[model samples]
Target chain A: MGRIPWRLMFAHFRRNKLRAALTVGSVFMAVLIFGFLRTFIVGMETSLAECSANRIISASRLSLFAHMPKSLEPEITELAEGKAEITAFTWYGGIYIDSDPKHYWGRFGTHPESFKKVYGPDLILEEDAWQKWTDLRQGCIIGSDLANDENLKLGDRVHLTGNIFSGEVDLEVVGIYRSKVRSFDQKTLFFNWDYLNETSKAAGGRKDCVSTYCMLLKNAADSGPLSAKIDAAFENSPHRTMTQTERAFQAQFNSMWGNLPLFFGILGGVVLLACLMVTTNTMMLNARERIQETGVLKTLGFTKGTLLVLTLTESLLLCMFGGLLAMFIVQSVDGEILMFVIASVPPSTIWLGLGIATALGLVSGFFPARLVSRLEIVEALRRRA
Target chain B: MSDNALLRFQGVDKIYKRGDEELHVLAGLDMAVNAGEFLALMGPSGCGKSTILNLAGGLDTPDAGTVTFGGEDIGALSDAGRAGWRSRNVGFIFQAYNLIPVLTARQNVALPLLLTPLGSKARKEQAERALRIVGLGDRMEHYPNQLSGGQEQRVASARALATDPRLLLADEPTGDLDATSAKDILDLLQRLNRENGKTIVMVTHDPAAAERAHRTLKLDKGRLVHSTGAAH
Candidate 1:
């Protein structure tokens, strides 16, 4: 029932400065990658959390590329007993003039009136800007992020050279708004659906079609039944509908990204395995060098169990130090640079990193601790002599 | 065996195998050491002098017969049980003065006391007293690498004496020391046995180191062939 002297443990590490640092460094690198993967998973969860529980999106059953007829919008609105607000948006690809050809922002031709009611006050616009956006045929609303990136304000006209639709389109930005929901992706441009339909028909393209129909319920609990009813209404039609909650719709990107969280998780495991091997070798070397000291400890009445504990505790302390250090470093470095995605290492991820580090210690210390515990005193002393 | 014997070896057999050749180091050896007596064992290489001390300290078990300490067969105990008994009964000093290089002299001396249930502060105080008894009071903070040959041995002796065990076993404790350092170590061991009345079993090749003991037992091939300055 004797207590381990933590000072002795630290002394061993302190004496072998390089080996200790390398071991701690190995753990840090491994757990940092592990924590980074965990952060990505957390970021995905946080993004999903922004989706309103009451909102649903109805897309073409086969693919997002397949179009649904605009006639379904009126039918869905009539089916609702004053309980639903419906809107529709056609996907428009907008490439800004005088910008990088590789980069593009989403442009959508959405029903203006219903879009305002469905999306709520997160789409903030001045009264004049709102009126101009609704009144003018060529008027469009830009997200705050897009306006800031292009250095535009209300009434500032932007020229876009379209790639998907062959045209040089000039649209005046009548409003700039921000979305409270992160999954809504605030780098978008929205114009009136009638303007898009008339322009597309003039350009000899298909008319009366949109990519998706979005619905918002007054009571969030009506989502499941309303979704079923909406899907049933068009199930027999050529443009069959697939209705899902907004969160589930956004989750489709997980497949688009090839389930990056799983890939990152596997990468984290590989890094941890590599670190475990390196740290295990370092621990074995430390143990080998201390055979005489272990024999001395045994001769002084230290039991095999006690030696094992000391060895394990030494490694555990190293790993814990590395894990906490990585947490601190990641916290300091996150969101500082200009990146496409701002991934955050949450508090839970830090705790998880510590747990992983503890497991690393247990695994890495096992061989060395067992070797020391089972060493014969006569043989161990003879090793040095 | 005498009733007052602190340690007894009855018909002890020890063997070593080197590449399929069996070297019989000890053959049915019997020995007894009385309480509070300083007994030195001297022999040549591979003579089983250290093997006998190892058995007496419960560090090893004989192939035949029992090694008993304080009327109990220590060789009969389980590994864990023997470790517990050894902690309470025996303190060992090695020839190399094996102090953990990382720990200070005070910490090294306190190591044996750590096996007890005593608090850390009490262990430190007892360790300090042990170091002071060996006249290295001011060197408590020095590490083994920083201390001299004689100082390291004294720190080791302090460690052995710190727990106040009933028996002290030294296996060529002065083998690595210079003549002056060796004499100093021998004087410390003699003082511990005579002044402190501790029962000591020491294995040494040096006759001068053996002379410090109250009696000397000459061993040839693990058999006690002769003795001087004490009755067998």
Candidate 2:
């Protein structure tokens, strides 16, 4: 076997500068988009997986937006008896700074007393943060990251303009808490459910319902049976309940925006196809222009396999360089603002993208190399084009 | 033809297919060049002169007869085997001074040596020696684009000589050069043949180029119509 035509192929790129750069750029864009998309899915879903296995989330069977009566909380608690502690969990879509999306963070209305019992294991808080949240009626706890970003501290007043429901709301930042789990985003603002109810009632809107009931089981293994028992108790009521483990509930919550994973997968596929087309087109042009040179090498006794390996390797190296660089940027930079979940992409996801790069390189390299390698020497020499 | 001729073609036939057209390029071509002979093939375009070189160098197979080098049938070898045989026995020089544009003169000359078992140091020594023989030792590090037309051809000739093969094939070696450059290349060829006793088969249309050889065979259509040199 002959050696790889390393220097020759390297110089070919120098001969066609714009084409090579464009090809590499195309590969870089494809890899960057694909990596970010996979990271988004993995970061969000993996964090959801960290939610305690002992917790069960029960929502309206008809729709996530359907209101469930808060009066059934005690009945659910009774059904679980010693098995669980229960709380109300309601999403609050509020604009913190006018309507700019960049200032966005989560706002959830929950029963602060039971909220701690349900989520205590994952929370890291100041010594008196819990007491302050319970002692003050209009007090709320902000995530440590959110507090730091907004420069908010204890006793700091925060104003929110309601978007989903009517009327503005005001609350004091009573505590700054950080979460041990990323899926439970550290940039959320959690307040008492009773505070929201009293504010709405004073504004001539009586709040009688909660969005969902969260039950934290005493034993992790009892989550399934306890969830079923609670749901069965409310099966014949006016508003039916669908109860599931928190992880399953989070999956359903993600599906509320549509099949995000499949959408991103298809988007990534299209980008990759475009990358393949561009790179293959450039490689084919390179191969065609050098057909006579290939003939010259063949006459000098370079075997078909040697030429094929050399050509294929050149293409693969170019694409891999672009791909590996894109993933490196994905790692070095924070994408929390873009991903809206966790910022840091996992190393596993980077390795997976590299696998995609290798496959992309091979596929894009094969056809052009095969065409160049399979030509007869006499014919190739005649092909001056 | 002598039974011990270094390169022999016996009743060789070559046909080319172009879409629907069947072109007969060579028909029953019987030729022989004894060892140490300098032979030339002259003809118009499409007359199978280059085809004969391709078969002799094992770059292409004949449709009908045997092409043998030193009594071993090269056409009978597999693709890989023929490539190996060519690397071991034949060197090729092209009309366009076909040096790789990317490689320095030394690197281009070292290409065929890559097929040999010689270490890098040995290959480098052989390439430099071959370049020095062609009087381009000073330009060994220059790329083909950096060298003149005649100098590039010298580097190509050095590449052809780097492996020290027994047979050399030159197809229109001076077809693309000016008169001065052409003469210098022809002189180098004569010196290699005389000093190294290398068997050479060159294909060219110029009578002056053909005159440099010991024998000249002229082809019209696909058959040899004239032979200016004595038949072996």
lDDT of 2: 0.85
Q: Where does candidate 2 stray beyond 4 Å?
A: A31-33, A40-50, A53-99, A109-112, A126-183, A191-213, A217-248, A261-271, A326-352, B1-4, B17-23, B229-232
On TM-score, the candidate that comes out on top is: 2
Superposition error at B119 for model 1 (Å): 2.2
Best by DockQ: 2
For model 1, the stretches where C-alpha displacement exceeds 4 angstroms are A45-115, A121-182, A185-252, A324-352, B1-3, B18-20
Candidate 2 TM-score on chain B: 0.98
Measured on C-alpha atoms, candidate 1 has an lDDT of 0.83
lDDT of 2 by residue, A1-385 (tens): 7666576777777877788888778888999999888877877677677867888899999999888878988888889887888888877777897777767888888877789988877899875888888888788999877887789988899888766655667999988887787767778899878877767666666476788999888898998888788778878998889999988888787777688889999999999998888888888888888898898888888899999998888788889888898999788644353445676588887887787777777888898899978999888987885
Question: Clashing residue pairs in candidate 1, if any?
Answer: none
Model 1, residue A80: distance off in Å is 13
Q: What is the DockQ (computed on Cα atoms) for candidate 1?
A: 0.50
lDDT of each: 0.83, 0.85
